[model samples]
Each structure stands twice: as C-alpha cells, then as structure tokens.
Target: ILILFFVMMAQMVVLTLPRAAACLNRAQQVLEIEPSIVDGERTLDDGAREPQDEADAVAVFDHMSFRFDDADEDTLCDLSFACRRGQTTAIVGSTGSGKSTVAKLLLRFHDATKGSIRLNGVDLRELTQDEIRGRIAYVPQKAWLFSGTVASNLRFGNEGATEGDMLHALEVAQSTFVLDQPQGLDTPVAQGGTNFSGGQRQRLAIARALMKHADLYIFDDSFSALDFKTDAALRHALQGETRDAAVLIIAQRISTILHADQIVVLKDGEVVGLGTHGELMETCEVYRAIAESQMKGGE
Candidate 1:
C-alpha cells in the first residue's frame, strides 16, 4: 500500500509542474503588453539650437596648429589658408582630417596655439567677440528650425527681412512647398523642425541663413541632406549670389565641390592638395581616390 501511494504522488508532481510552468509563461506574456498612454507628460521645452563657432570671422589662418587636451596628438598642424572675398573655397577630407578644426579656428571657437588669424585683414584676436561674429551666417549639416511659422524662422535671422525676401530665400533653397502649403508662410514648424522631412528642414535652415545675406557664408556639410537635383539648384542659386561674398563649403561628395574655384584637400591635419578640380585630378592621389569612390558610389 505504501509503494502504491509513492507512485501516485510522483505522477501528480510531474503533471502539476508542467501546469505551473505554463501558467507563469502566460503571466509573463500578459505583462509584456504595453499599456496605452492616454496623454503625454511634462511640458515641451522649445529652444533654439546652440550656435557653432563665430559668424563675423571671414577668416585667414596663418600657420595655425592645435590639439585638444584629451587628444594624444595635435589635430591640426601648420594649417595655413586664406578665405578671400568673392570665391567659394571647398575643403574635402576623410573623417578626422581636421576639416572641422579649420572651421572652428575661423570662428575663434578654439584659438590656434601658434599662428595668427585675421578677419578681413584685421587680427581676429583683437576684435570684440560680437564684432567678429556679427556679419557671418552659418548653416550646419544638422539643420535646425525653431518652433514658429516658416516666415518667422527666416525672419529670426534678420528681423528686418521682408516676406518677399523670405520667398526669395525659399526659392533659392530649392523649395516651393513652403509656398504650396495651405498656410504658406503662416505654416507652423515644430521645434527642431521634427514635423518636417529632412530635405524640408535643410531648405528651411538654408532659407534662414540666406535671409541674413551675410558677408561670409560658412556651410559645413549643409548640402549633404539634399537630393542631387535640389543640390544642383541650390548650388546654382548660391553661385550667383556669392560673387561678391566669400563662400566656404566643406563637403565629402566630389560632385558637390568639383566646381569650386579652389578646393583644399586635407589628409592628417595638413593640406594634401589645393587647386581647381582639373588641377586636383592631375596632381592629387587622395582627391583622385575620393573622386573615384564618388563615381563608383554614383553620388
């Protein structure tokens, strides 16, 4: 009788163990389902994006070199370049070749440890901070727009700017949708322009910068977001406007910078080549490699 009781107990334990495991599995599945959120929490903070570098420093760097404290070695070494009036100068390089460093120095964000930077023949170190940055307008690769109507954001760059000027800027930026929107200039743009497409955001940012009509335009990979057709049109617009003002363009695509009056190619903190597109093709292996890569990539 005792042996029969033990066999019955073992069969009951085996059957109950599987049932307990399956129950726990079902509980876990129910717990994983997300509860619907009835409403969002917290207030939305609408703020302007941080400005990079200085604006007014239409730049000239003479034998500049620098390194960050965290860096094991200098990021820029003996960098000498002059951005003059009425020409688009382009810089192209692979990552960490000190392309951004050059722009930073021009803006006086990081002063060159050794060398002199002059803005319009005036030494930048001597100029007041606001005086140096006031006349320059910049458009970064990561375009940002404040929470406001499209017209308001463009007007933010130059408060005195007119609706006609805003329309012209939008046109130059290769965007007609701003005019097509039912609200047109009155259409609201969310903070950071999150509601807009990437290309639209880029156009709005460009429109804002163009409204400033600044003496110097610093474009750091600004065209990287646009389609090829839009890019060509934007370039055409800029080309005509930039005849009297200096344009500095930093780009990775060979197609974008090929028509630049002067192209500066950097490799490891030094200029590997500098010249027109045709001149670079003949003399620069690095430029040739980039050109070939772009060709293969069909960008």
Candidate 2:
C-alpha cells in the first residue's frame, strides 16, 4: 500500500509540473510586455469644434498602416477609407486579409504605425483613448457574456438602462427567446455564455450593444452564427435603431454586406477594391470572384 501511494504521488507531480511551468512562463511574458496603446494626455474640450450633429460624426482612415511588434511586415498596408454617419461601410476579405485589423485601429487597440485616423476632423492620436472609445459600441466576432443575470449583461452597455430599455434592445436584436424564459430578464447566464446556443449568444451580444447610444457601431462579423432569416430581420431592425450612427462591419460572407453603402475589399493587407456591390461586381475582379463563389455555394 505504501509503495502504491508513493507511485500515485509521483505520477501526480509529473502531470502537474509541466502545466505549472507553462503557466508561469505565460505570466512572466505578460509581466514583461508593455502595453502598446496608452491614453493621450490631452482631452477634447467641450467646444473643440468636433462634429456636433450626428450626420457629421465621421470616421476616416488616411493612408493607415500597422505592424505588430513581433511581425516582420505590416498587417494593414496604406489602407484608406471613410465610414460616414448615417451610412454602412462593410469590410470584406479572405482570411489574413486584415479586415478585422481596421476595426482594432478605430477602437485604438493599437495606434497606427503610419498615417492618421480621424474622428469628426480631429486626429485620433490627439484624443484620449476614453474620449475616442466612448463614442463607439463594438461587438466582436465571438460573443462574450459574464456569469450573471441577463439584465446584468445588458446593463454593461448602459448601466443607467431601465427594464424598458433592456426589453427594447432585445426586441430590436430579435432576441425574443429571453422573454419565453421563466426568469426573463433575470435568467442566469454561465461564464462565457456556455448555457446559450451560439445564435442565442450572438443575439444577446447584439442586444447589449444596442442598449448603448453611440456615434459609431462596429460589428466584427457578429452575425456569422445566425440563420439567414434571423440575420435579415436583425439587420432590418438595426437600420432603424442606428439610423444616425456610422455602422462598420467586417464580414466573410458576401451576403452579409450586399446592402452596404460601400464595400471595402482587402487582399494581402491592402485595399484591393472599394465601391457598392454592383459597382465592385462590374469593376473589381476580386470582388466579382468572391460574389460568384458565394452565389454558387448558395445555389
């Protein structure tokens, strides 16, 4: 019995030691790295000549380029585009084409290595991180939810939101599944929303973002999980809710961006085409090929 006990103890140590070492190495890496993005010292004044009207609140990327600290080449290369308020701009590209990097730049996750990003005529570098991010509501490709009641997760978007606001957001997101739950707004969610289906989690994430009132809305392939019917309904509702805000979407599916005011196509980290769906189909071979491929798949 003593020999068996000793063998079990030795096996346990052998199993745990490598995991512990790897965890320590990761913690050490995190401790050693400095944050690449930091808030600017200056704050925008109330009368700073920024766009006062919602229609004028525009986001512009001018000759922007970004390279990760460890990467040898730029992830985004001389990308230029404008997302204007009251219009939808969709970025579509193959994987590794840097579509999502554009959203990160706008969110100021990393400052551009070259050129400038401007909001309402002011350079992003001149504004505090909070000042820039406060005006944008972002929904990432993966939906993230904390362990709490449904109402609590929705409140993260706007703490001041009332039950009425929560209900309205759910309605707009077409997330009526919550209403059928016995707990309704109070339904408990597990960490990372493991309790919900992928489509349900996405709808909840969209509802949470809809609860906030912001100048810009960024949906980074947020609808990839939904069925075609739900996707269409949610987008229809979103148009009404975000009529005055600039909407930027990064999508892999051509169907998701067909109705966008402008579609920007990326290839190998460069802007290969920029135009409406019909315009791109006629003028850009890359866009035409993508559309044709998707059309065949759908058929």
**Best candidate (score: lDDT):** 2
| CA deviation > 4 Å runs, candidate 1 | 1-58, 296-299
lDDT of 2 by residue, 44-65 (tens): 5654565554236579888999
Q: Candidate 2: TM-score?
A: 0.87
**Model 1 lDDT per residue over 38-129, tens place:** 22221112231212442323567778788776888878887777676678899999998988777776666766667777666556565555
- Return the TM-score for each candidate structure: 0.78, 0.87
Per-model CA lDDT versus the true structure: 0.79, 0.90
Candidate whose TM-score is highest:
2
CA lDDT, candidate 2, residue 236: 90
